[model samples]
Target: AREVGMPLKMARAVQVGGPAWHWANFAKVARNFEWEKKVGNSVVVREAVGVVGCITPWNFPLSQITLKIAPAMAAGCTVVLKPSEIAPVNAMILAEIIHDAGVPAGVFNLVNGTGPVVGEVLGTHPQVDMVSFTGSTGAGKRVSELASQSVKRVTLELGGKSASVILDDANFEAAVKGTVSACMLNSGQTCSAHTRMLVPASRYEEVRALAQAAVARFSIGPSLDEASKLGPLVSAAQRDRVLNFIRIGIAEGADVIAGGPDTPATGKGYFVQPTVLGIKASDTLAQEEIFGPVLVVIPYRDEEDAVTIANNTIYGLGGAVWSASDEHAVKVARRIRTGQIDINGGPFNGSAPFGGYKQSGNGRENGIYGFEEFLEFKAMQFKPSAG
Candidate 1:
């Protein structure tokens, strides 16, 4: 908990993949196979792609590695795992568990080093058939470029500047609270955090007040504390980066309704106060990914304006739509151009394909879609019997 500032209960519940769920996902790969009955005497089959290079990020270290390694191994592809050095202890422990599980030695391997050395080699290696990477957009682009040299398949789960659109007819209190939670979860280090919130222009002050109050309710303290709803960021650099964004948000003329650029009184870890800012829809604070406990509220003129503001970013990762009617929320969600949008605080489903559009990178993860990333297709032809 101290190392990464994640609350113990939350970390324990989510960070490590439980035995049954992990095995269940492995079993899912078996179901990925299909028998095709074509008009002619031909059959199509899916086969293991080949060796896979899995580069996972520091956030949710064990889960990210498991998401890649389990599916790849299940698909029959050998894996070379490279976990972020920032939070690699759990990854090392996971490797021990996999080893104890009796996976063949050559089937799985772990390499510990920086992105420039080990990561670059993995991406460019001709023998590596595919690379599944999760990290920053810049790093993902570099991986794509390097992997392109060998024409290897690449799947990237990159950064996101997601939005949470609050419709005029939605329950104001519930929507605001839900959006605040979505924004500040994991101290806003999440790639899919709803950092931007869109509300009707006429109700801007009302929404802002609710959002500010919700942010205030968040208890910021040491991660080990059961009362703490928010914790310090990952590293000194990340803390500095988030603080810089707060400064920029202020310079951009956004009103800091709650929290500020000042450091938390603890003066201990990389703690940033839970921040909420009210800004113009087109402001820089509304566009950039701060990767902190900073939420930007942007008021829209109407439903059309809300959708327009939601899709105005270069990123199209995750978002949410809140409305009194489910049909109306779904309709607005369909137009938002994001990869995934939660409707009225819908719970996240692990089986669903999770990914993004545009600069958020390509390809999906989770369930069968994730497993297929390690597989290739083949077709067999047979002559029709002559009677």
Candidate 2:
């Protein structure tokens, strides 16, 4: 409760005048399952029908688990949670919290294991009615295929290769700094991080210098430190994956304009310095999802070219646009194929729908959008006075 409250307060402080920025708001709405029926005229019509399979990732462990569990409980559905083994400790803590919260036995269960073993089992299990997965596009595909045999409803929030387009008219310093920070947040593990930066060729050198300096100034260290702007990759395997992408960026001829390789002399945990790569529009790094502290900076001739380069990737989960004029930025943002686009460093609203396009996956989460995922719609008509 305290941690949730803190996030709410922080969001309110940052967003100001936004939606009811309180944890109580979430709890309150979560308690009201009838609201869905009232609005959509849809109901489960069957109580404790079957089990819900929740396969969550390591990032944002508690929140993701809660996102699945809370609604399932409200709908009177039992759940079998398979949280990522890399972050299983938090799952244990969450299971304790749910148990202490007085949720009934057999209503919520936790299974700790890898994706291939536990996740596949849960997805393919005949008794499970639905599966909610949050992971990579590759994993999401497999989960969907497995669930299809049972004809179970599936919801997925998968990988993203987001782009941040800096228009020629935008403030070069602010745009570069914001894009760099977005790329470095969560050590760039966030599915919606703006990893591909599109800049006008006229301001390419100027933006590159600013972004390079910004990446150099990021503080990478342990998660417990409040001052640490970045944390180590979740595990050694993730660290290696990120490092391999960095190597690929170099091999593909993307200029290492900023931080690269591992942090020097940091022996305790897995750490990679924030890296920035300047590549041509056609480079492989410019079109791939490097889910690390690696930014691919591509130069474009104009707004049209910038939009083209930004939308050239297979993933279209999220993006950003920066320009001197809000109207111009909005116009450019509309051209991108991403599900969500931020203009001028605007805040992210949890109440809005969040998902992706293309290989980034389908469907949405959060607000009324997320609530409808578990629902089945049926329309009925009655002929009056026919008798």
Top-lDDT structure, candidate number: 1
What lDDT does candidate 1 reach at residue 76?
82
In order, what lDDT does every prediction score?
A: 0.87, 0.77
Instruction: Give per-residue CA lDDT, model 1, range 1-387, as digits (tens).
Output: 655687776776766544337558767655655524464687777788899999998877777888888888888899999999898887788789889989888999999989999999999999999999999999999999999999999999998999899998999999999999999988998899999988888998898789888988888888888888888899999999999988988998988889989998975789999999899987888878899899999988898888888989889999999999999999999998888999999988777788999889898888887777787878889888998
Q: Candidate 2, residue 244: CA error in Å?
A: 1.9
lDDT of 2 at 114: 96
**Candidate 2, TM-score vs. the true structure?**
0.88
Name every residue pair that clashes in candidate 2: none
Stretches off by above 4 angstroms in model 2 are 1-26, 30-50, 385-387
Task: Tell me the alpha-carbon RMSD of every candidate.
Answer: 1.6, 4.5
Worst 10 residues of 2 by lDDT: 1-10
Tens-place lDDT digits, model 2, residues 1-387: 122111232223422222223233345655664532322333323233358899998756665776666656655678999998876876787689779978788988999999999999988999999999999999999999999999988888889889999998888888999999887766787789999989888877788789878987776655555556666776777778888888877888878888777564545567788899889888877776777788989989877888888888889999899999899999999989989998998878777888998888887876656655655554433344443
Candidate 1 local Cα displacement, residue 230, angstroms: 0.8
